[model samples]
Target: MSSYYGLPVLKEPVWKVPDVPAYLYLGGMAGASSTMALLADLTGRRHLARAGRVAAAVGATASVGALVHDLGRPARFLHMLRVFKPTSPLSVGSWILAPFSGLAGAAAASELTGLLPVPGKAAGVLAGFLAPAMTTYTAVLLADTAVPGWHEAYRELPFVFAGSAVASAGAVGLVAAPAQARPARRMAVAGSALELAASRRMEARLGLAAEAYRTGRAGAVLRVARATTAVGAGLALAAGRSRAAGVAAGACLTLGAVATRYGVFEAGRETARDPRYVVEPQRERVGAPGSEVRGEVHRSSSDGDLQ
Candidate 1:
């Protein structure tokens, strides 16, 4: 493999560390919390439902703040809402975030204030309906990028994200309303299992791109994430009405989810910084004798169509 004067083929992501990772964490938590709230309400766990609503509202608000801070201007976010492009994950994500934030806020307010109960339930339901997309769209956004680590893992990224979201929401429930958190315990156990399994599969299948997740800062955080998530899930299963144990499990789960997001972000950045992640794959695709010319002709026609 070779590079153009030893330079990275793709530009490194400009997204700031804490801001982008925080947005991903909070958005996923908010989306899953909304869904959990609706489920709790249906199951007659009023306290748990209320807690979920509040968590969703606060998470969504903070998520938006983090995003706008990264963009350096609120107008940039508003500009995203000016057009809805289904083919573009960013555009679709903006639309999902806007309504989800509003609905989550309304649901939380209604639940807390005892006013407009009808509208609050309606808002909660609608937010729940949008929750899955809200939780997973960030994965799509990441995968759509040119970064090898992220793009190559697209097949399992959504599952990893969704599981993390659910686990985070469960953590909130455990922390906020442990007395009525049976459903949360179940979610915590199930979500963590799914996340761990999907993540392992993604890494195993990533080939050379997996180097980004196996070395450097990304690897350290991901290792911690896996350990904490597994511990949290085990603790959740044995908690069984023990408030202290539930809280401990919740804390561990929250840390794991945060670490996972940060690790993934760092892995993507690492891939962009290394030229091999770019050159080696293309070389393999066009390695055979006479294949380079044929590949160039195919790419030329594809580029023409795209143009």
Candidate 2:
């Protein structure tokens, strides 16, 4: 094997901070808000339903702005939609985001203006249907890349993102609509638990490749996120009796979710900088006893274990 000690195994992600993380956070909130709107409408919680719709619209719209800004040009984003590739997460995500933005905006407008009630309800339903993909596809987009921190955590990343989405939606609902507080609290607690568990599991499963999550600035951010998530979820579960407690819980959840996004982004970049993460695992895979063929390509069967 050729030895190149200082060379990077993969290119660092070209995405800028704040912009990419903002896009991720807003996209997730958009999806979660759509789900909240649907659930609130079904349960006759009009205030929450209206707030959820509005939040969905705002989040979706802002997400597009963040995405376009990150792309550095509106034309590039427009060009991305020129083709639909089933295997390309960016292509599929763009398509999902487009309809989702329209539907969410329409639904919120109808609620705000009290016009076209039937069409608004239909739009909300459609947005809810698309919300899962909107929230989870970001995870898929990251995992589809060659970054060790991302691709190696594919299995758990979806759940982590989904949980964060639900938690964020719950936080927004709690802060925006007092009537649906109970369900919102429940969602926050459940979502935080899921996020924490999935993150720990992903790190554990990554084995040696998980260093990016353990020993750097990314690790510090993730550590804070875990602490805040735990504290926030605990407070949320017990926040029913006091408005102050509820708001505090909501703020913590929002903070934790943002921290998680930044930490994940940083971890992926850090992983790409280290060559051992790229070479060692593949080397072991190829050298394993009873391997199919000498120097044959190795496919990992371990869940979320990347190349």
* lDDT leader: 1
By summed lDDT, which 10 consecutive residues of candidate 2 come out lowest? 294-303
- Candidate 1, clashing residue pairs? none
RMSD of each: 4.1, 5.4
lDDT of 1 by residue, 1-307 (tens): 5577888899999999799999999999999999999999999999999999999999999999999999999999999999999999999999999999999999999999999999999999999999999899999999999999999999999999999999999999888898998999999998999999999999999989999998999999999999999999998999988999999999999999999999999999999999999878776767766797667877888889544
The lDDT of each candidate is 0.94, 0.88
TM-score of each: 0.94, 0.93
lDDT of 1: 0.94
Quote the lDDT for 185 in model 1: 92
Regions more than 4 Å wrong, model 2: 1-5, 293-307
Minimal lDDT window, size 10, model 1:
281-290
lDDT of each residue in 59-127, candidate 2, tens digit only = 999999999999899999889889999989989999999999999999999999999999999999999
